[model samples]
Target: MLLATLAGCSLWNSGSSKPLPADLGANVAVLGVRQAWTARIGNVGTLPLDVHVAGNVVTLASADGVVAAVDARTGGDLWRATLAEPLSAGVGSDGKSAAVVLRSNALVLLESGKERWRQPLAAQVFTPPLVAGGRVFVLSADRSVAAYDGATGRKLWNQQRPGEALVLRQAGVLLAVGDTLVVGFSGRMVGLNPDNGSVRWEAPLGSSRGTNDVERLVELVGRTSRVADSICARAFQAAVGCVNVARGSTTWTQPASGAEGVHGDGDAIFGSESNGAVVAWRRSDGSRLWTTDRLKHRKLTAPLLLGRSVVVGDDTGLVHLLSRADGSPLNRVTTDGSGIAAAPVVAADTLVVVTRNGGIYGFRPD
Candidate 1:
């Protein structure tokens, strides 16, 4: 299976010998960021766990099926739950309810840190379940989407598309734009009617090209940047583009070799290339604004636009803060030395990052 092959290969490294991580020069502390509080969860290992932020709460899960909601402002535990089976994907929440997928292909729903109900799925899920508008949406590896009542476990609807020969084992795009449920199917950004799981519109961001399935893979990744009606996402290692969800048309697409997703503000979109170069592009025309290779060879997560800085975490347990205007270093912070497990998220004025060793650190401006 493609999943097994992907699991063993490094998306960023193609050669036999891995390159050394870039050297980080002396810390020139420009931005004033301080660790506010630290908490612990079960080790995340390699699971594609997403840190979900809603209001002041940060919802996350560990590979061992331990899910918890923490107050980003105070680092206080709001609620925590442990599922019977280890999780394959998770930490999706709507503040009131949470959902996750077990390794056994079961969808579990929780409310107030208690399991509400469970439903069985036909395929493996890597993307976190999306909980929105009293419904929980699950996107599986088999190119299928299913919806269920958030309050109950009753299945509402299921929509299956033609399965591709291979699909990425990481998180793919699935979000809500106004009243439509926007999802990623291969290289396309599709808008679906949330009420009935029907297709509303489709916009292609990447297309198959190479001879083999692996080279032709262009699944859209998550951690997308959404500014009002404009949603920008990365199509695996193929390209980055933005779509007008309201008009159901693609605005622009620029070829970019990146395996991770992207994040941006109103004027610019930022992404980390597979080579670890940080790039900023004009959101309107997809033109290059600036590129920095100082952090090249360091595996980076999808960037987060925080205030005047772009925040990115690397495999060395370092969170880098760079200038939004020029991609220059502004500040850097250290975690538990186990590397960041997911992209950084902001909540209640606190910047939260999770480590692979299960350390959750909350930072605030000093």
Candidate 2:
């Protein structure tokens, strides 16, 4: 039985007052960027919404279950669909079929903006479904993994792991590396055979150390950085590690106190610390290469490596682009002023960011 739910597990620590966010005194335009196009959806508020990008098409959903596929190049809607209920998790698509979990624990699949089928789930899901190979995979809060036929809503298989006394209410890892379905169970990154629910390999990144249930929570978060066969992920506020999927072995693990995910190029991995400091680590050995406290106490989302810049959104709706090599500020952009709701993503050379008030703005090099 699940004993407790830890919401926004990475954002808070007890008994300590947060420092004021660093003052962003003036706008310095070093790198030129212009808002290319803008779109709107329902207020996302604090949802764990992942913006799914397949080529130039970007699929995303609102808290009220309004899913839309926007052309990343032109900011035009390819299609839009609305479900009757609010969404718990969603907008996973393969450019063909999209899957989202309703608040009622129903997995609803859509094709070309039309509802294909809906199936009920036994547990709550916060991670966006992984839709690949004509299958929809969901990782629920109860530590269960299930797959369904993408076309017919028929249950393909279900695998349940022993539940922890406490679990996070935020999104956890659920991604695909080649033919294997990789998921996070507690602090271990487990690889499973996608065809049938079978364990391929399990690599531990963090372990329960503290006495209390809250302190022992070490589940992996989403938005992991993958470079070829090597995938790197953050184990909550415990550690950052990379696993060689091909060999089913751990590459490296370094202590990381971050609540968000990580992103990187092949050489270095970048993440934002819980205190809002940005850090860069060597991908090969997990060595700390650089750290920037420019955004401290700002409440940052996960980092996104785009070209020569590490893009990160803050709680005030400002997206900062820093030099990937040395963590220097390159440029900063603004959004709806309601704060950024999700991490910034790139599609067709346009940087797309969603605001808490449901503003989707696309930016391009000016």
Question: What Cα-based lDDT does every candidate model obtain?
Answer: 0.90, 0.90
lDDT of 2 by residue, 1-366 (tens): 444767774437454675789887777777888999999978898778999999999999999989999999999999999886899897789989999999998999999999999999998888999999999999988899999998788999998998577887778999988889999999999999998989999999888888877887889998899999889999988899999999888999999898899999899999999988999999999999999998988889998999889999988899999989898888898898898988889999999999989999999999
Instruction: Note each model's CA RMSD in angstroms.
Output: 1.5, 1.3
Error of 2 at 219 (Å): 0.5
lDDT of 2: 0.90
- Model 2: per-residue Cα lDDT at residue 342: 86
The alpha-carbon deviation from the true structure for residue 318 of candidate 2, after best TM-score superposition, in angstroms, is 0.5
